[model samples]
Target: MNKQGTFVAVATSILAMAAAGSASAAESGKFQIKAFATKVAVDGAITKVKVDQLRLPAGADTRAKDAWVPTVAAEYFFSPRVSVETICCVTQHDVRGSGPLNGAALVDNAEVIPATVTVKYHFPLSSGVKPYVGAGPAYFMVFGEKVGASARALGATKVGLSSELGAALQAGVDIPLPGKAVGLSIDVKRYFVDTTAQFRAGDRVVLETKHKLDPWVASAGVAWRF
Candidate 1:
C-alpha cells in the first residue's frame, strides 16, 4: 500500500482493536520494562541549502543509512489504561550524497540519541491483548559526526549536526504471557525531526544545509510488568 493508505490502515486497526476490547479492563501493572531489538530507518534528505561556499553540484541531496540497535523502555502506569513511557538507545548513521552527488559520502559515523517521552492509552481486550497509541515530545541529540572521506577530499575539515527537538507518534500491541507479568510486545514510532549540517574547512564554514531526519523506529521484544 501507499504511505497514506498504510497509515489509514494502521489507524483503522487501532480503533478496531480498541472497540473490540472496550469491555475488558487492562491488566494490573504499575510498572513495566521492555527490552527490544530495534531498527531505525532515516530520511536524511537535504531540505534547504543555507550556505554553499564549496559550490555544490546542482540538485545535490543526501541520504542517511539505516541502523539496527538494541533499545529499552520503562513505563509507569497511572491507571490500568493510562501510562507514561520513555525509551533509551543510541543509533548510528552515515550520510551519503544523492541525486547529483550520488555515491559520494558526506558525513560519517554520526551518533544520535533520541530521548522520548510519551503518554499512552492502552485498549484492553478480553483475550488479554493490549493495543495502544501514543504521542509525545522528543529531543534528538547528535554527536560524534565526522566529515566523510569525500568531503575531506574537498578540503572539508570538520562536520557537525545540530541537536533539535521534535515529536513522535507511536502505535503498538502487547500480548500477555501465561504468567501475566511477562508479555510480548511489538511497536512502531515515527519521529518528526530535522537537523542542520555544517561542514567546515579550516576555520571557515564551507557548507550549511538543513536536513529532515524523520525516522521510523520499529521494535519487537519481551516486556515485564510489576
Candidate 2:
C-alpha cells in the first residue's frame, strides 16, 4: 500500500483499540495511551545564499512555501503527573526564488519526516480535567527531493537539503468523558528547526542558503488509560 493508505490503516487500528479498552481505562491505571490527529503549519525564514563567501545582493529573495499535513502521537505515563510521548508526521514543501532569480522554481514536493520525543508534566487540577506542558527534541529526515522543471531547464543539476535537529514545546489540556474511560485532548506545539538548502549543477553549486522552519502543530483527539 502507499504511504497514505498505511497512515489511514494505522489510525483506524488505534481508534479501534482505544474504543475497546475504554471500558477499563477511565479509572487511571499505570499506563495511559492517547491517540491524536493533528494539523501542522509551517512558518519559515530563508537566509540569502553566499557565493564564494560573498552574500547575494538585496534582491535575491529566496523563500520556502508553507505546508500543511496530518500527524499522530502516543503517550506513555509512568506516573500520575509525568509521562513520555512521541509524535511523527510527513510533509512536502515548494521552493521558490525572486529578486535576482525571479521566476526560479527550485524544488517541488520535497518530503520531510519529523520524529519527536518529549517528557511531559501533568498538573493535578481535578479528577476529570488535567493541564500539561512538555518539551523535547525533534529529528527531521528529508528525502524525495526533485529539482523543479524550471530549475532543471536552467541547467541546474539537483536539489539537496540537509536533515536537521530541533526542539519542541507543547501545552494542552485533557477533559475526561463524564462516566466513560475515554477522554479528549487538545494541544499545540512549536518546533524550532533549521536546515541548509543546496542547488547544484554538475560539479558547481548554484545557490546555497539556510532556512529556519518553525512550525506550529495543533492537535485534538481521544485517549484511553489502562
Candidate 3:
C-alpha cells in the first residue's frame, strides 16, 4: 500500500523469477534432440571369404574405405546425470578385394544403416562443459550390395549381405554456446559389428565373406535442451 512496500514487493518478485530461471537452467527437462555431421571410419579388415562353404584364403585381407555419414540422435533424460539416447546413420563403403584378387575386381560397394541405443552418464563441470560416456547395442542393416565388373565377368550373378547385431561405446562433451539453450557437441563412438556376405551365381552360392566392420564414428554438431 505504501511506496516502500510496493518497491519491496517488486524486488522480491524479480528475485524469485530470476532464481526460478537459474534453477531451470541448472536442470534440463525430460528430452533433448541432437543432430550432427559425422565421419565414420571402418577400422576392421574383412575376416575372410568363402566359396560355397569353402574358405578363400586371399579374401581374408579385404578392406573397406571410410565413409562420411550424417547422423541424428534423440535422448531422454531419466535423471540429472543419466540419459538414454537413440542414434541413426547411413553410410556407404567401397569394398576392395585383397591378396591374389587384389583390386575392386570382386566387390564394388555396399550401404550400411545402423540404429544404436545407449545409456549415458553425464558429468557436468563448472566450466559449462558436460562430458558423458555411453555403452549400448546397435543393429545394422546392409543393402545395395554389388559385384564388380571383373567378378560379373567371371560369372557372378548376385550379392547379398546379412544383417547383424553389435555393441557400441561412446564418449562425448557438450559445451554451452553463448545462448545457454544451445550447445556444441563432439562425440566419438565405436561399433563392434560382424556380418556375413554371400555371393551367388545363378541359384548356387559362390563366394561368402565375413566382415568385421568395427567402425569408429566421430561427430561434431549442436544440441538443444528444453
Candidate 4:
C-alpha cells in the first residue's frame, strides 16, 4: 500500500478506538447552565419602502441601530445522546438619524424579549471535546417606549407572537474539576432568530418591523450532575 494510504488507515483506526474508550468519561446524566450575553446585527434596507419610510433629515442617506442585552439559559440532558436547551434574552434597538431634532440628532429606542428551546445531539471528538447541533423554536415579546418624540410613540410597546426556527452548532471542552463531581466547560453557540410586528404610531401604521438576529454566544460555565 502507498505510504499515504497506510497512514490514513491507521489514523482512522486510532480515532475509532479513542471514541470508544472515551465513553466512560462521559457517563454524567443531566446537564444545566446559566450564561450572560451581548448581541448585535447589521441593519439592511431590504426594500425601498422600508428605507424611504425611515424618518431622516438632510445630510444622511442611511441609518443603523446598535443593540445589546443580557441573557441566561438552562439545558437538560436526557442522555449522552440527547439534550434540550432553553434561553431567555432581552434586546433593545437604538435608532439614529443624521438630522436635527430640537437642536440635536433624532434618536429612537425600542426593546424585545426572546425565549428559545432546542433539542440537540452530541458527538464525541478525538480531543475529548463534545460537539453538538440542535434546532427548534423561539417565542418573542416586543415592547418599549419611543425616545425624543413629542407625542408618546407607542409603536414599539405592542406585544406580538412569533415562531422563530433555527439550528444551533456548538463545541465545548469539558475539563475535570475537583472530585470529578463537577466540570468546567466553555462553549460557543450561534442562534438564528427571525420575526415581524404589527405596530403603530399615533393614528398611522408606524411599522411592521421584522428582526433577524443571528447571535454568537461564548459561554464559560459549570456543569453539575445529580
Candidate 5:
C-alpha cells in the first residue's frame, strides 16, 4: 500500500529469480551438442598374395600405406560430467604397383564405413576451458579392389569384407565463447580395425591378402549448451 512496500516487493522478486537460476545451474549443469570434421592418415600392416588357390606369396614391402580421409562426428552430453558420441566416415587408399601374370590384374583402391558408440568423461577444471578424453569400440565394413591390366597379374587381385572388435581413442578441449550457451572445441581421434580380401577365379582362391587399417582423425567445431 506504500512506496516503500512496492520497492521491497520488486527487490524480493528479483532475488527470487536469481535464486532459481542458480539452483538450475547447480542441478544437472547443462548438456552440450558438438559436431566436427577431421583428417586422418590411414595405414595398413601387410599385403599377402596367393596363386591358384594354393601357393602363397609375400611382398618385400611391409609398411602400411597412408591415405588422407575426411570424417565427421557428433556427440550429446547427458550431464556436465558424461556424454555419448557416434562417428561415421569413409577412407581411401591408392593402388600399389605389383607383378603381372594372367590377363586378370588386381586393381588397387578401397573404401570403408566405420561407426562407433562411445562414452565420455569430463574432469572438473577451471571455469574458462574444459578438456576430456574417451575410449570405445566400433564396427567397420569395407569394399576393396586390386587391379592390373592383365588378369594373369600375380597379386593384382583384390576382395572386400567386414571386420569387428574395433577400438578408438580421442581427446578434445572446450573453450567458452561470448554467450554462456555456446563454445568452440578442437578434437582428435584414432581408430584401429582389420579387413580381408581375396582374388578368386571360378571359385578358386588365387591371391588373398590381409590389411591392417589404422585411421587418425581430427576436427574442430562449435558446441551449444542447453
Candidate 6:
C-alpha cells in the first residue's frame, strides 16, 4: 500500500483499540493519541555564505518546497489542565534557487525528521471546546540530501545538510465529539531552526552556506483518549 493508505490503516487500528476499551475507563484516561494530516512550509533563505568557490550571483537565494505528510502525536496528561506531548513524522523537500538563479535546483530530495516535545496548558471553557498553547525544544534531523542537477552541472558531486536544534511554539484547539473519548484536533506550530549546507566536488569543498529553515506546521486530525 501507499504511504497514505498505510497511515490510515495504522490510525484506524489504534482508534479501534482505544474504542474497545471500556467507555468509563476512557472518560478518565490520561493518555491521548492523535493522527494528523500535516503541512510543512519552509523558509529556506540563505542567511550567510561561509565559502564561495562556485562564484554564485550577488542576489542568489534559495527556497525549499513545502510538503504535506501524515503525522502522529502522543500525549500524557499530568492533570486536567496540563499535558506533555511528542510527535513523529518525516517530511521531504527540495531547495531551489530564487532571484538571480531562479528555477535552478540546489538540493534534491532532502528528508527531515522534526523531532519535538512540548509541555502544554489546556484552558477550561464553559463549552466542550478546549484551547491550548505549548512551547518546546525541537531537533531537525536532515538526511538523504543529493546534489541537484544545477549543482552537478557546476561541478558539485555531493551535498550535505547539518542537523540543528531549535525551538517550537504551538497553539491549537480540540473539540470533543458526542463520545468524550474521541475528538477533533486542530494544531499549528512555528519552528525556529537553521542549517548549514555543504557542496563538495570529489574531496574538495566547493561551497558552504547557512540557511534559515524556519517552518510552519499545521495539522488537523482525530484524537483518541484512553
Q: Which stretches of candidate 4 lie over 4 Å from their true place?
A: 1-29, 37-70, 97-109, 125-128, 145-180, 195-201, 206-211
Candidate 4 positional error at 73, Å: 2.1
In order of appearance, the predictions have TM-scores of 0.88, 0.76, 0.81, 0.57, 0.67, 0.87
Q: Best TM-score goes to which candidate?
A: 1
How big is the positional error of residue 71 in model 4, measured in Å on the Cα after superposition?
Answer: 3.1
lDDT per residue for candidate 4 within 1-226, as digits (tens), equals: 8433543454455345435544544554576665544454534121222322335344432233555555666778656656677877767654443334223322345565656666655675665456665555555454563443422242333323234554444445555455667666666655554554333454455544454545555666665545
* 57-176: candidate 5 lDDT, tens digit per residue: 333222334555454456675556566678766765543433322122334455666777666655547777878776666687666544434434443343444465576766788888
Candidates' lDDT values, in order?
0.89, 0.72, 0.76, 0.50, 0.58, 0.87
Give the best candidate by lDDT. 1
Q: Give lDDT tens digits, candidate 1, residues 133-158.
A: 97777999999999999999999999
**What is the Cα-based TM-score of model 5?**
0.67
Task: Please give the lDDT score at residue 86 for candidate 6.
Answer: 98
TM-score, cand. 3 vs. native: 0.81
Write model 6 residue lDDT over 16-127, tens digit each, in one string.
Answer: 4334433324233389899999999999999999999999999999999999999999998766666779999999999999999998999999999999997776765888
Q: What is the lDDT of residue 132 in candidate 3?
A: 85
Q: Which portions of model 2 miss their true places by more than 4 Å?
A: 1-29, 52-57, 98-104
How many clashes does each candidate structure show, in the order listed?
0, 0, 0, 0, 22, 0
**Candidate 6 Cα deviation (angstroms), residue 9:** 40
TM-score leaderboard ranking: 1, 6, 3, 2, 5, 4
lDDT at 123, model 5: 54
Considering TM-score, which of the candidate structures 2 and 6 is the better prediction for this target? 6
